[model samples]
Target: MSGLRPASAGRGESGRYEAFDHLATMVAVLRAADGCCLFVNAAFEAALGLPRRALLRRGRLFDWFVDASALVTNYQAVVANQYSTVRLEALLRRPTAPHAEPLPVHVIVTQVDHGETILLELVEIEQQARQDRETRTLDQVRVTKELIRNLAHEIKNPLGGIRGAAQLLEMDLADATLTEYTQVIIHEADRLQALVDRLLAPHRRPHMVADVNIHEVLERVRSLVLAEFSRGLTIVRDYDASLPEFRGDREQLIQAVLNITHNAALALAERRQAGDARIVLRTRAARQVTIGRQRYRLALELHIEDNGPGVPPEIRDRIFFPLVSGREGGSGLGLTLAQDFIQQHQGLIECESEPGRTLFKIQIPLP
Candidate 1:
């Protein structure tokens, strides 16, 4: 509770509670005697699917729970100095549109100000699981990147030596027919060298900085992808006109987007033959987005959605890993490069796929 103190009130009590609004976790403050709601943070309010005024009008925070008996008994115990903190699982009722089911949550209630004020935090069980999963994924990706970078460096020098030796052998060969074998060795070595370069490209390239218009980047990707798949692929632009320009490497963004869009086009091969392949490039401004561990007040959301057979269930999770591909003959570095580029801007990329639709979502913070 050291830095958790409410801000000093200048205009009103609600103004003092503004400090809690920045937190990604749901928080509520209530009077301990009767469990009357005093303040609800942005996350809490959003979870309850109600405005602050409406929530306060309802009064008791306990009423929002499906079974208030557990909370009520715990609240009384905490207020009576029986305990300083209590943690339990509960089902919270949301009466707003789009929330059709009771939300399962982990609730933490702590006595503050000598048990006069109660601090309550509610973490959605699903949200907590998602955060945990994302944390694990990020950690795994970091370890994988480090290993790949080190392995690529180890292979790089030997690769050049192998190609040079093969070239020298070919030049000194007595029989022209035998030179074919050396040529094969040189060609294969060059191919492996190229593969190693792709693996190391993101680490080697400096992050160039400039103001980037996301729409322009998408349009560039759209045109490039359409050029390759000229006949049946349709790239639809659904741009948010009010989105602000952000500082980033314009070329990197373009290439990242191009990679994703090109993959979507390739996935639509069967649909392309039918002349109905479609991809949507949608952009919007996202609020209160938690990317990685940091929460951003505003961020850009770019979704590249395609109407193709979704990513294979077997390889879906590893799509961003180097050399893991759902498509045949895929080099599998596209999504990996895209992820690395977006991460260089302190952003993240996620994919959601089903039978008929696959969406690649990218999030970058805005000023």
Candidate 2:
């Protein structure tokens, strides 16, 4: 309350001052009753690329926002009703920046009465990073799943027919050389059948939603990785033990996590140095995350970080697409399937890779 002061008046005239600061991704501020800037934090300045003096002269906070009218209306309501806190999101525009994009911000406004004027605090939503990732992952999964279903159905019938014809040809063949050709046809058909089976596996199965302890799944993946690469690679765990159980298909989640972790292990396997091949599993809890444009109360964040050489830069953007692989012999379906499973649980999977570091982050909402 004491921090509220008119912009025309100096800071010393504001009397005994109290500052409220919250750590958030973007800029934030506490404003006076007249909508003058009282306290503007460093994040706000950095995000807008503006100095505190410029912000102070800007007068009402709404003036800088892209849709200032709506914000002003909400603020006025708070003032009239003595509302203690209100949350909203809006597009913000810089005064003279033409090349900058309109930034989406989640704002939290609070009314405080320290003395003669009302005070309001603003918090920008940086948590949107996770939300954006969740949205893109969901979209990718949906499209990939549909493609797999269609492709599998199209190839499966023809593959069976070809295999049956090859077997019949083998039975009718008199020459041994002719039978060898039939065997080759049968072998290739079998390989195609196997690929189709993998493509349809997720849909053919049913999902069993149960309260699952994520740590247990991570532990199982860890054990499996160690057993496969016991000699050289290392699997590290950075778990938050207090994480609550979330409703999910246990086996599906396990497989989804395994696919990602296994791919990392394989990437590490090709590295020359033994100790340099390291995979770290980290987990945390996040709040107010949006997936598929729908907001959720809480979500679990899982990160699989590796120290091996990162994904190739060329195909990085399309890695989640069907049949995209960085490895020579890889089937490229592992991540696609993993993404599908996670999307079924209303979650997402995202990756960021650079030389010597690659991070795959999975976020699933918790009930």
Tens-place lDDT per residue, model 2, 173-243, is 78878888888999999998888888898888998989999999999999998898886787888999989
Model 2, residue 289: displacement in angstroms?
0.8
**Candidate 1: deviation at residue 163, Å?**
1.3
What are the runs in model 1 whose C-alpha is more than 4 Å off? 2-6, 9-11
Q: What is the alpha-carbon lDDT of model 1 when measured against the actual structure?
A: 0.88
Query: How high is each candidate's TM-score?
Result: 0.93, 0.70
**TM-score computed on alpha carbons, candidate 1:** 0.93
Estimate the overall C-alpha local distance difference test score of candidate 2. Answer: 0.76
Q: Candidate 1's error at 139, in angstroms?
A: 1.3
| lDDT of the candidates, in the order given | 0.88, 0.76
